[model samples]
Target: MLGRQQDEHVRLDHAVIGGNDLSEIDDAFDSLGMEPTYAGKLENDINHLSQLGFEDGSYFELTATLEPGQESPWWDVHMQKDAGPTAWAVEVTNIASVVDEIAERGTPVDGPNEFGRERPDGTYFEYELATLGTKEFGTQLPFLIEDHTPRSNRVSTPTPSVADTELVGVGAVVVGLGDLDDGIEVYRQAFDLPEPSRQTDEEFGAELAHFPDTPIVLATPLAAGNWLADRLETFDDGPCAYLLRSSDWDRTTERFSLTGESSWFDDRLAWIDSERLDEINVNLGVLSP
Candidate 1:
């Protein structure tokens, strides 16, 4: 188990969407009225781009392997499963303590590995990541990251001219699970997430276990006809969707229409189909001002 608890609270750093079709995914984001604030190449093997500047500090990262056969092990595994919005990352203040905690729990972690990328402006951004979920647990678990530099320096603020729709923060990350109890046990042991309050959504035909203190929600299909069930059937159990909060719901919906990407929208929520989002579900909901 993790060592004595530190004073830091777990916060989401970013969510990753990976695909081989870089240009297509880029175009899709563009069509959805989102503009990338920063772009960079990782080790000349992967391309990384971000649309940041959220008031709440969470960001979205779009990444793709540069070469056909020379993909990293992580990207290769994600692509083999479904390839879009594959991994999510959490920010931890003490990297070594977090790493030690996982190791002591019998989960062999790969790093406190340092990595960096060059910004378009020629400056470099560096950070250390401790990878927890591996071959044993599968790639669904989020890795822990600590930045050496200020996060604002790495992710710039989005201007109104560049961003038509405002993404305030991540409301929840929807994790698909084979067994709800097993999934809860794993996340609790790894991240110290609290016990979830369970509920059933009749509209989605799914049962949800909400961990209100954290940014994760565990989803399991009650039957075979719902969206969650279909996803669990097609892909391995992992992160399947992200519920993003919007600053202005109406304005965001108007922008969505301008993109002409097929999406479903109500007054409070919008669901962008996976076909338009690199096979990952993007749900946008309104956040109260």
Candidate 2:
């Protein structure tokens, strides 16, 4: 039903990837060929942030804790576990209206809470946040953001190093679930996404469901000892992978020293080895055009 709406209510804002150290996060992504810009510390004083911006304005937000043993409302456990792509955000207009709509759909919605981070330049990046499903933050459901400052001020303009590359922006967020049916229902209730197309990847060892045309894919382990199962054991049900869009499929492959390749529904994608970017521990890849 949401897909039929005339005015778009939601769009991918950024993917939240947590790490133990900011310098390590920057170094890991730099080696991956997409350098991240340091966004400075949060007003809460718990974490420092960086942004890997893309042409579409969406980004991969690398978050690192400042105070060890201090609690971060959403990403404390994720940072502690070194969970890479732990949470995600969607941008929306009329935050109050969107919150009401999602609540009316039988999903619990929390806060248009004010949050901010100070940029290195001493200017502030202010925004409002609302989360869906649970308070834990990595709900496989997204938290919503509406910027008080210009969003351009919050997101780094693309640097020439990555701007010339084929990578576009975040195309899909792969959520690792314990149960496929339960995950599907959670997404359905939160956003009212239509029935998704389902499949299984023997190599990935998971069952997949792709919500049509959206940047959401739900994955559940096919058996014990699989990667998804291991991720769930530590990180629970939340984003496990983030695939960026590419303008040219072939150029994307040749541009980076890729670890392996795979398909997301019909689209082709290639990933960088996690070992290569061990500092960040992120499962990052690029999707073909």
Candidate 3:
């Protein structure tokens, strides 16, 4: 009977994509009809840029290491292996409570550490974060982010033209797990997340767990020769794709067509290949009014 309580403070914030080339990454997103804003340097080592703001308050961050061969934990852990979407962040209303909850569950927590980024206009945005679980979890468990400044100032609203397709928000993030039961237990103990609605998909030979009141779905491959199995082998059990919501599916498909990129879509949603998206899989679904 695990369910989301009203007091639960965590919500999806943003997902991070890492690359060595900034301009190339920016151009790729631009072709997707997204307007990116450069947020200047983060902690003085990583260059931060973000995509258009979504109604759900979730966005995408594209980052690149500014200092080559620098000993940066964020870059080394997330971006060192490949240039792709690697980590995600969650907004927490009360970080101390979250940290204490994790510690009570016998998981070693890292910071309550303060960090900030500057805008080109010279305004500074500050926040504190706490990391849950060990390095073994990698990008599977999102770090808790507590913002010190106004969220609007940190992420601007998107102004899309009538011809442009609107990216409404993130529907869910698809994460590949090493063990489905163990991953579920870890999330339940660490974050107190709601119980998931479970299903077995024969098409993919995977078990899917959709969490209540959250945009996270854990997938574990049940057999070989499936997309989940391929992702598990390639990314090694972590976030592999994001399910994005769009206001107009037709316009979004046309937008992808204009870029001369190959995409696959049905009546309900569209899938953009990772080769066109800086190695990140984007599944676009229609957003409800």
Candidate 4:
């Protein structure tokens, strides 16, 4: 429901997480039982984005800011935080064309500029990007267009074996917003979605909504400056949760050593990633929308 794309209009391309080091994050997930598949890397005059492939063809890109003297559009402004889920990448027929259509709707976007590297086989590689607006929580996902066709030899799909900690797909995303109702309305209107339902326990004012099957849940912090509220407060809102799933929960948890670090756990509701990303547990909470 989020992007206004029909089932065939755009393909779920990549779920990107912005961080300082791609290999470190990959290694952490690998140690967590995920058989990480190496995608390619990109380096311009400024930043870099590295992708990790899943068996199902979808992948996650880890983006990072280049050191001083070099600047990237995303890093200088959006990535000021130590690290976070910066954007999601979706691919359509043409990145620029989709940008035009999305822009017509008045969605804030960035260039779908050409970028690439020289390959070992004497071939050149390139791709384009058109960033969709960031969520009210500052989560920015883009529509990526690879330069090559699906049949090209560059695109390889590995038969992935179920890792102990394999994230099947994004289950639910919990966001923190300043104006809860307005934030929900923003997503609802953007994706042509419906109103959300309320589910609160002793702790939070949880309002959950869905997009077809994708669930987007929202929660109000117990205190104004709570951890979730503090860092993400500036964006008018920001991502508070990462709902991840796996083939084997025990194996996945074991691989990541989550049990050692997680402050909380619910066999079904939420679980923490042991290798902490910042102070947050890299929470795997909720389920598909």
lDDT of 3 at 179: 88
Candidate 1's C-alpha runs over 4 A off are 1-8, 44-53, 67-70, 80-82, 105-107, 135-138, 159-166, 224-230, 257-269, 273-275, 278-289
lDDT of each: 0.61, 0.78, 0.63, 0.49
Evaluate model 3: give its lDDT. 0.63
* Model 1 residue 27 CA deviation in Å: 1.4
Best by TM-score: 2
Candidate 2's C-alpha runs over 4 A off are 1-7, 67-70
Output the worst ten-in-a-row residue range by lDDT, candidate 1.
258-267
Alpha-carbon RMSD of each model: 5.5, 2.8, 4.9, 5.3
- Point out where model 4 deviates above 4 Å: 1-11, 35-43, 66-71, 77-80, 94-114, 118-126, 134-148, 151-166, 201-207, 215-222, 234-236, 247-267, 273-275, 278-281, 285-289
lDDT over C-alpha atoms for residue 79 of model 2: 84
Give the 10-residue window scoring lowest on summed lDDT in candidate 2.
1-10
Candidate 3 lDDT, 1-289, residue by residue in tens: 1111223454677777666555556666676656577766766555555455566577777766665334445646445444366677778877888788789988778988887777778887888888777743237787888888987767764434212346666655667787899989878877677787887655435687866666677879888757667656666666766666666666666655422222112113345543557443433323222
Where in model 3 is the C-alpha error above 4 Å? 1-8, 67-72, 136-138, 159-165, 201-205, 224-235, 248-269, 273-275, 278-289
Ranking by lDDT: 2, 3, 1, 4
What C-alpha lDDT, on a 0 to 100 scale, does residue 244 get in candidate 1?
66
